[model samples]
Target: MTALRKTTTALISDAAPFAIRAERASDVAAREALLDACFGDNRHTRSCQRLRDGRAPAEGLALSAVRQGRVVGTVRLWHVSAGGIPALMLGPLAVEASSRQLGVGAALMDHALAAAKARGHRAVILLGDAPYYARFGFSAAKTGELSLPGAFERDRLLGRELCEGALDGAWGMIAPTGAPLPKTKASRARKALLVPRAA
Candidate 1:
């Protein structure tokens, strides 16, 4: 009965054109393939893998854009903690090369975020091109006390507050819920995107 739940239900009932619900486990393979095609081999460098390590968001929060039953775009939100404060982290958003500009990515994002908010997630974070995510109300959290794991351009790390003052007093390393430090160099680089704040 919460606003988020009501909104999410409404969104689902009014699914966008050419969009369909994504099954959590059933869609992983296709989603991964779509991500590979969209991001190339360097996808891991984007910090996507690390973002969802131990706290992958529920399957209901992951969505895909389909046409003729083929996934053309996808978006995923992960459970993460910023300074131990719970939040959803959005990323690895990808749209098929052939499907760019078709509103596929936007649709997926809208669906996933509404679901997260409905589930009581107070905020979401991402390291992405600002111009693209701004339409969703994401803004630079430069003054917000949260940090990523490795070296990253500070400006690109952004957040959206689903609830007012969600990021207030939140500072510290943003980490996967229960995972250890990344082992590979690529993962290390991606982890750095979540710069840790001084304790």
Candidate 2:
């Protein structure tokens, strides 16, 4: 196994610095700032953010990498369903520009993924560079059935199965969890036509 895979296994087996922990709401500001610095202001406009908006997985799964009391990197997983099958979405992983080579980002991802597996989340989907994420077993082959709203490099949409065959038959347009589609005037008119007059 590669060092990254080995470290990921270790995180799952031992609750050390790489162990997954609950992210406190207090950590949001700092985490967001780190992400902003990494991805810039337009980050929220990305399709991944739409998948995360109201359905970020519990803070406990929002893992971070801290060094000497500073949050050097972070990773967040969001709860989502693919083809009506529940799965997790991994994204916006960011490391401070100055800390790029320190393994903080990898550690956070390893810890969060192990935690997801332990918690029974069977699969994870993410939009990111295939070469980098492939080290963790993420691949475009598994995401063949999934789709996104905005234009994206098809190979960039990737998936990983935490359990054997977890993504089989999983396919869908990733919609916001708990978010209702916008009510259009035409739909409202249809609804009005269906209702009986009030007595």
Best by lDDT: 2
Q: For every model shown, what is its TM-score relative to the native structure?
A: 0.75, 0.76
**Candidate 2 residue lDDT tens string, 41-157:** 688788787676534354457776765566777887877777777778888788887777666677878888888888888888899999999999999987888887777778899
Q: What tens digits encode model 1's per-residue C-alpha lDDT throughout 1-100?
A: 6999999977974664466476444565667677767777566665546666545355467777886677777887777888877877787888887777
- Error of model 1, residue 165, in angstroms: 0.6
In terms of TM-score, the best-performing candidate is 2
After superposition on all CA atoms, how large is the RMSD of candidate 1? 10.5
Whole-model lDDT per candidate: 0.73, 0.74
Please count the clashing residue pairs in each candidate, in the order shown: 9, 1
